[model samples]
Target: RTLTGHESVQPQTSREMLSSGHWLIPTIGGDVWLERPPPPMWWIGIVYTVTGVKASDSIARLAAVLAALPIILLTVGIAKRLFGKGVAVMAGLILATMHEFYSYAINPEADIFLCLIVTAVLALFVSMEFPHVRTTGAVAGSGKPSFFGTRPWPMAGFFLLLGATNWAKGLLFGTVMAAAPIVLYLLGRALQERSFHPLRPYLWCWGWLIAGAAALAWPVAVIGQYPEILQLWQEHYLGRLHRGYLREPWWYYAVQVPYVLLPWTLPALVGLLCSARAAWQHAGRERFICCWALSAPLLLSLADGKHHHYLLHCLGGWAILAAVGLAPLWGWLQDKLRLIPYSAALGAVAMALLAGTGGILWYSRIPGRWGTIVGAVVFISLATWVILTACQQHHLLRAFVGILAPILAAYWLWVPYQASYLDDYKEDLVFLRGAESLIPNDVPVLVQYDWTAPLETFWVLYHMRRPGVLIRDPWQAAEKTANGGQNSSTAYVLARRLDLPLYRRAGTVETVLESTRTRGEKNPDQRRVLYRIHFTQPLPPAPEDYLRVVRRTLW
Candidate 1:
């Protein structure tokens, strides 16, 4: 953290903004710079407003807590339609109370938005079958969703919104999401004689709506902002997708699924295996949903570029399938393992009771934090009751993750306070801010490596500006140091602790900012070590970036 009070750490994107804090507005005659994600997906500004504290605190992540309710209600309703009310409630509760999703959601990340959107899409797909039935007493829709017409407009609208949001996040799940409606429409066509006829006109409408929505939200090609429409489109969407060439193992997402869907939800994988035959024989709505659920993650699984959050939108889809898989296994387990669920519950109850007792002893010392105690008592009592009353049929893993649900709920809520501790690194950020205050605001700054992340996001949004150049290789960094012309400017160096000695001896430099290591994370041998060393000499200003970053953020 390199800012005021160390409440949050500096991510590269946000840091770039800090250098240009003097200019928060883009004037008519000034240069126009399109940021990576204009008004980010997670609404970091909203997060900044709420906690009134920057850096990394649990307090700012209010989005997930508020979103949990809808995720629970919608998933439950879908599960009820597919399984039964009994499993529906359990499924909904399991998801609403899931610790895994909660962990990913509360971080100032885009997954929560994806999580809710995917869940809604999945639930809506399921509702296409039994439109008349109301699971959570929510509004009911027609059996066939009218995405193409007035009736289907809502679903179509949702798809468009979600589709753009997906693209904003590097088009993370774009291919998969785009394929869903096509597949659904295709399958629906095979069954029914006519569906959204005149494929040409229908495609026209689809293209217009999707494109219009994208143009409105995409910062790079903000419609009227530029006259070179096609050129800008290619650069923003197509170019961005190919630029970030970080390679990941192909099987990354597939391998993590077991862990993410842990304990109760893991066995649900069997349902996916069975769904193939089930879909072939039935071709029912459930079958359509089975395809929809797997499509997004399946595509992500195959992509050369991959990240864990890429398939987050599928969490709800996976949960629904997990419900289907578990509902059956839950029954079989009752007879076979008679005592397993109870064993797990007993273990949970004992743990909770012990915790509650511990709370009683510690409450005096930690008075205001009793929300912790109250939360523990409620969930533990609830779990004990479920264990005592959940007559025979229940998935053991489900029951375990379920019992631990309240504990995690308490943890997510309590841990945000510790974001303040996470903010400890912010002092370094403040030092950077202080440095910016001293230097001539108009002077261009050269960042020696690829500097982009949460910090950069903040700096950009706040309208801070600086000419941030990325000198990727050691040779590039070395070159600027070797040529100390008067035209040269300041360059920041990122290097490891061990290399600091070597760099200082070799070059004129100022300011070395080290990042607090992510717990258990160490500097990669290849990743330029994290020290932010400002070089005395800057490389010759390149025509493209020399003045642009500085002009935007400063006078």
Candidate 2:
């Protein structure tokens, strides 16, 4: 359950910011981390100060949890406006229970916040531009006045939210993601309506001028202090776009759609087809939702840098579309199965539950998991029964509950089970914790690792609870240990076991700790060893390496 990979960056940066009192600029290992903006770190810092809690994985993730609430509400609002209440509930539940959304909901990262801001922006834009059109009935001017009132105020709110996306990430990534769909929807609407009216407002809106100024405020303020950020921004943006950083084929996101949507994949696919058909036939909410759902993936695929989490911002559209797809399917099931007896339905449900329970007991042979198994089975059965009983007459909602309840229960059970028993990074954690216990607080730790694995070095430093220097070139190990001293001094160096001979050439190396792998494990790349290096004599200086300091911004 320890934070690994990019998850460690949030707390590490937050800790650095709080300790250094540098809220405007985020630093890691006493260096300005220009890779991301400060909003996520600021949110974590606020949570820590208000709750008096130390920075940990759970405390840091609380910020993500808070950010996800608005996304659900906004999705429900959009769905309710577009379809009816039934579809609204389905959309909300689909988004809340999605595997990808759940994964990012608990992760302390900026993607979820970006998704929140983007969803709000899109919802505000839709409410302003499109009247509410229900599937069963059409209402004229059903777009209710927002809290800021009608006309230019709501427009201003939309632009402001779009501008705030910069704070969520950096370099206008969110702005691009939010704007693409809006432009596409407007173009599509203009073509459908056979007029240039929809395009006019977007071009002449005064709110965009204010929003542009507001969006530039953060970058301008930061650049005024550290002008080098301009270069960093250029490199970061251009590198990701054209320089092949984490490059993937255009079909990468297309392939990941099913996995991202999980249980609703089939429904979403159906809904996407339905939306396309509806859009082709007439200009309505389907056209907008289709644009919203498809724009992110299509636009992101153009970038060389592609990640599965990058699509998180567009999940609301997919969720609503899935609801749209489910409504008709639900109606068909109701009509076809109406003649079935309640006793037969209950019997089938019981049999399916029993089969699932048997599989769980059979497969999960881990010790001390019986309690979770029993608890899950009991809770799922009781909850399913209550839901079925309450909505027995309404076949559509009952069917949804039947499909959704078990998945939710299983997810609830899996969290504790995975946290307690499943740890893929246990070897690294064990080695780091062992090194922390063996090494003295005053003794500086020099992590001698190849420049390729920044996450490993970051994991060590974050858990070690001290700033350490990185010696990417093994030849500099002795020079680092000497610390410009001719007298005797000791420092611990962490290196792979395979690279022990290289460090032994630098100084007197004594193995202090070693990471152990499970039996039959064939991967030798991760076998790390901590060595206590003693410097009796000064060593010659080596040429500077590009990665001498521990940089946490690589990810």
Please give, for residues 474-507, the per-residue lDDT of candidate 1 as tens digits. 3355555346443343444443344455445434
The candidate 1 region of ten consecutive residues with least summed lDDT is: 1-10
Tens-place lDDT per residue, model 2, 240-309, is 8999988999899999877898878877888898778777666578887888888988999999999888
What value of lDDT does candidate 1 attain over all alpha carbons?
0.48
Task: Quote the positional error of residue 463 for candidate 2 in Å.
Answer: 2.7
**Model 2, residue 532: C-alpha shift (Å):** 2.0
Q: Name the candidate that leads on lDDT.
A: 2
Alpha-carbon local distance difference test for all models: 0.48, 0.73
